[model samples]
Target: MDYFLQLVLNGLFVGAFYALVALGYTMVYGIIKLLNFAHGDIYMVGGFVGFTMLTAASGAMGAKGGLLLLIVVMVLAMLTTGTLGLIIERIAYRPLRGAPRLSILITAVGASFALEYGIALAYGPNPRAYPVGMGTGSFNVFGVRISTGQLVMVVIAVILMIALDTLVRRTRSGRAMRAISQDPRACLLMGVNVDSVIARTFFLGSALAGAAGVMAGAYYGKIDFLMGFIIGLKAFTAAVIGGIGNIRGAVLGAIVLGLLESFGTAWLGSQWRDVFAFGFLILFLTVRPTGLLGERVTERV
Candidate 1:
């Protein structure tokens, strides 16, 4: 029972990271129905940004100011990645909005490779060690050990998710997003600037992913340019599992996937974790194409 509880704890922390990345995937899909395959690269950008910021800050701030420095690094990384996302949408996606879906998808793939190699060219193809480390300070709850760093990370994820939920449910911009999602033409007729809303959506979604990247780097202590690729696929699976267009569903699916991976790793050894995750994806797609909260909408011929 203690071992099971420990696995659950591990799953929750990892799930929080997955949820953050998945939120970005779901938000972009919800607004524009385009799967931004490049979104994961944006996450890799965040990790590097945070790493650079922390490395620079270490000389001046030292270990005493670690937490404070981390907070600043996270914000800076978010802003940088958010701007990059806006640029990608404007230069790559916006031009092809009226083009075929396949065209935009190919463009996204190109963008992903561009970002990945661009980072590699700049930072080299090697993994960099995260300068900041969470000291070994932990307490046990019901014979299950938990670290302070993991606790802090999970709390931050929860706070960000809640804030995003509130923004989407209560803000005017969110209303515009939903309006555009339902009918872009109608929203334009109703005096909404569809382009601006879409741009903002990309910015916000990318910013969240950037934040997640920083958190993951802090937790895992190593980062690389290609780190986002597999995680991006997993996050997309979570989005699909929870209903691609549903924000809350994305979080739900991520947590579920995280837990499944945890238990799978425990039972079948760590080697089969990815296989287990994808297996569930296949099961979900085959059994329930619409997902848990996704509704079927018939297209007009």
Candidate 2:
């Protein structure tokens, strides 16, 4: 029972991170119908930015600047990455908007590879340890040990998801975004700036990925150029599982994937963990390809 509780708690944390990152992929897919493969690199960039800031802070203020400086770095990185997302849309994606989907997809793949290799060149081909000010202390919940960092991460993820859900459903900008997503031509006729709306969506998604980057840096304690690849794949899987293009679906998918991975790793041994998890995904897809809450989309004749 204790072990089960521990796994559940840990799964929640992993889910939070996955959900946050998956938001980027699913949102862009919803609005643009493009995968935005470079999203993982955006996440990678955020991690590196935060890492550099932490190294500088530690050098200047030692342990004294630990918590406060970390906060500043995260905020800066998020804002930077958000802006970067806008530029990426404008530069790499917008120009190809009217092009063939295959062309745009190849371009996206190229962009992703460029970002990855660029980071490798800049940061070198090595993993850097993330500095943390927090000590490992936990609250005992029915013989389950849960740490402050894990709890904080989960809370932050939930709050951000709620905030994003509200932004999309309740706000005027969000309405414009939805209109654009449904039919960009109609949205344009209705005086909605489709390009701006798309940029904003990317900004929001990238910002969330940035936050995930910081949280990962704090908890996982390592940063590498290729770090985002595997996790990005997992997050993409989560988005698909939840219902691509649906915010709540992404969150739901993430939790299920996290729980599945956690339990599989613990019970079946680490070697078969990913295989088992993806195998379950395949089975789920066979039954319900649209995912838990996904809408049935039809093609126009």
Regions of candidate 1 where Cα sits further than 4 Å from its true position: 62-64
Cα lDDT, all candidates: 0.91, 0.85
Q: What does the lDDT come to for candidate 1?
A: 0.91
Candidate 2 ranges beyond 4 A from true positions: none
For candidate 1, give the lDDT of residue 265: 98
What's the distance in Å from true for residue 29, model 1?
A: 0.8
lDDT of 2 by residue, 180-199 (tens): 77799999999988999999
Q: Please write out the lDDT profile of model 1 over residues 144-175, one tens digit for every residue.
A: 99998898888889998999999999999999
Write down the TM-score for model 1: 0.97
Question: Which residue pairs show collisions in model 2?
Answer: none
Per-residue error (Å), model 2, residue 171:
0.8
